[model samples]
Target: MRPFDPRLVRELPQTRAPVAALGLLGAAAGVAAIGQAFAIAWLVTALVGGGSLWAPAVTVATILAVRGILSATTEVTATWAGARVAGVLRERILGRWSRATADDRPAPERMLTISTHGASSVEPYVARYLPALVAAAVVPPLAIVTLLVVDWSSALIVVATVPLLPVFAALIGRHTQEATQRRWATQTRLAGHFLDVMRGLPTLVSYGRAEKQADQVAAVGDRHRIATVRTLKIAFLSSAALELLATISVAIVAVWTGMRLAWGNLDLQVALTAILLAPEAYWPIRRVGQEFHAAADGAEAIDALLADVPPACFAGRESMSVRDLSYRYPGANVDVLQGISYAVRPGLTVVTGPSGCGKTTLLELLAGLRTPTAGAAEVPRTHLVTQTPFVLPATVADNLALGTGASPAQIAAACAATGLDRVIAGLPDGTATLLGDNGFGLSAGQRARLGLTRAMLSDAAVVLLDEPTAHLDPASARQVRSVIRDLARTRPVVAVTHDPELAALADAQWPLTERVPA
Candidate 1:
């Protein structure tokens, strides 16, 4: 976006090491290549004049072997650097959004693009484009300098023509940038549309609309194909033009060197070496042009991600307090939550509410997951058990111990307290059992209890539970309510539920209605 974004170095400090390594390796490799060009010329000259060739041949082989090793190293390091850079960028993005409210993050479709395929595309830019950039920087200057010392006539021709590569590339980009941007926008939308539709296909089928979208999908696919082909055609033509320019430039140098050789102004070795070194100056710049065309999408993605900077949050307190706070969604005319005052200390506070009255919003506010609109919240480190808790396709132990340093004994103790120990014991592998998303093979009650178990193991000063016993039977509900009581004895506990049994045991109960609020 900014040609070469300086913020990439400022923001992602981890990338500096690999990029510097590439630059250094490129310089070293360019030096070796220059030496190898002379060695190759000397070998050819020896063969032509019937001179002894062993020394020059060995020199050429050794330089080539060194270059080969450097090439392999460059390849591996570039790959590692690409994946590493992409990984760090993705981590920063996901971590930022994980701590942000719904108002701050992009839609799910765009977020999916940023975290997955978008991150994947950056690998090519780093592995290919960056190396080419280093080569274009190091090889061309070094080659031109070597040519100047060997013969200024060849150097002058190279210096004069190399500028045309970037100039031609710039002209091509200026002509196509608008179309490229439009096509890329359409490409992103089409891809996101297909993915979103696939994810919601079941819902669409239930609503009798799935079959209707097939023609739309086909139409979008065709449009994407046409746009992609057009973009590729421009890209290929631009690259071809640069290649042709480079070839003609190199030919000019070769013909000048040959003319000087025939006139006895230059020896065969210098003439041959000048021709070999001349091409290196042009190709690195040309390769850079090709890679830039290929990597523009990744560059744009990086720009998009870096522009979204997340804020820092500190732990406020180990209690819940909100005084006359009101919150509205961004760009909304009405408030999702009106002026409300609530406070909680070290005890059980049960909030009962009907649907869509900002119950979960209040809990999120208390957990420091969202900021207040017009007031302050003195909420502390909190462990919240949402109605639908996070479930990973990992072993049971991994799920329970996620984001906590709880040991096995502590995990088992918490599980026992929540009556989930029996569920884990009944499984074939106990705490090692593998689960699918949302805990497949486990009932909703078990999932809820597992979530409760995880919450119980948390070290947070406050615990927030959302319908912890919604899926459980009477007996299991009683067991969980007992665990809730046990949890309330030591720390501040906020439970959002409709169960009378749990409410009866609460130290406080606030109903969410027009007359009263929590």
Candidate 2:
């Protein structure tokens, strides 16, 4: 990982102010610390000489108070900035995912881990590491410079030994970065597995595989525990090594100063100030090493977040068309689809195929959800209604109003068109009633109609539906098909289905067959 990535400032201009503020705070704190060190040295010299103590004691107290205030302000600023940066990163990751093509995005599970846990992990890096880094940069040089003027011998010892801290840190940091990456990868997989298990819990229980899933979760959790312990062990060992080195270096300086003072060659005030300034130069560098190891996971996350992401784009053509389109899964050698071509205009075009024949894949390609391996798909902005469309645990009106931002009248009209108006009228609060997660209160058929209702309200140039009539009863199927017909009147409508009745309503039909390897 870089000490500080310039991309952080280049891509996220909002973070620049926070980072600048942190730098300023760190510099101020460093100045205060150096002043306090001198003040304490003066007070000690006065007491040892039997001189008046009141003036030097008051000066030390005032400097200490200033140092305390600086410390508190740095923490407050770091915390607020850290939270804001993490929030912005999450927003950026999720926002980019929303506009990215299916092929351009990671799987749902990986995306979940990165956008949630991974984004949150960056907080420590911003809050602790950055401030520590600024301190290391600002304080060590200031302390060394002060020592240079007062006692060049102590300054030489400090300058020589301070380099060792970073050298040791770098050696340890290489290992730490590798360990952190492994731990983070394991964390991502563990999170993904848990998320998958939770999402499929009902299915597992129904199939009597819940016990097996529980065992798998336990195995993964154990692995994660082991990985975490290993990472922490490395961090602790490295921290201890740094502490020992700094302590020994300071001891050497103290020994040298004591020898000179015993011979009556060194003055009391100079000897005391040299002792005070020695630790100042070492502690900030050591703290930087400590915070660096601690924030390794966050460093990895920043790399992932700032990686280049290409946005999904669709052609601005009036009609959706595909020419010799072909596609394959990421690892598979054989193509899922090949040598296919079709056009969708302002009328209903139905796609028919048997199971595993790439019907849904074709629609996804046309909607810019997936990129084709060969040929091109020239399509306009499209709204795709997948099987089991997304529903939130929110007011029915709010869910319907998603994406389209339809007015109340438009929503009512769309609901009436899809036969959802009757369902809403029977509810306690009608459109204002809250539904359960993933439409718990609604039947499969109602949910299907709800998706179609969204499509009806959408103003997208093309509408793609996957099995729109699959979950509906005969009456509901007919009603939904009528709405589909009406929608096709204004824009291109493509539906993937086996319903012969719905297929009969199509103006044109395209049949697909599974492609076999040559």
Specify the highest-lDDT model's number. Answer: 2
Summing lDDT over every window of 10 consecutive residues in candidate 1, give the lowest-scoring window.
Answer: 509-518
The CA lDDT of each predicted structure is: 0.84, 0.89
Candidate 2 weakest ten by summed lDDT: 303-312
Cα lDDT over the full model 1: 0.84
TM-score of each: 0.92, 0.96
Winning candidate number (TM-score): 2
* Candidate 1, pairs of clashing residues: none
Error of 2 at 502 (Å): 1.5
> Which residue pairs show backbone clashes in model 2?
none
Report RMSD for candidate 2. 1.7
lDDT of candidate 2 at residue 104, scale 0 to 100? 95
**Which tens-of-lDDT digit does each residue in 390-477 have in candidate 2?**
8999988888998998899999889999999998988889988999988978888888989999999998989999999999888998
Write the residue-wise lDDT of candidate 1 on 1-518 in tens digits.
Answer: 43466777788999899778877888888889889899999999999999999999999999999999999999999899889989988998988888876656777667876677678878887888888888888899999999999988899999999999989988887655656576657766777788888978999999999877877788887887888788788889999999999999999999998888899999898899999999999988899888876677678778766767455354567667788877776776767777788888677899987877778888877776677788777677788999988888999989998988998889878988988989988999988899997689688999999999888888888999998889999999999999999999999999988888899999998677532333
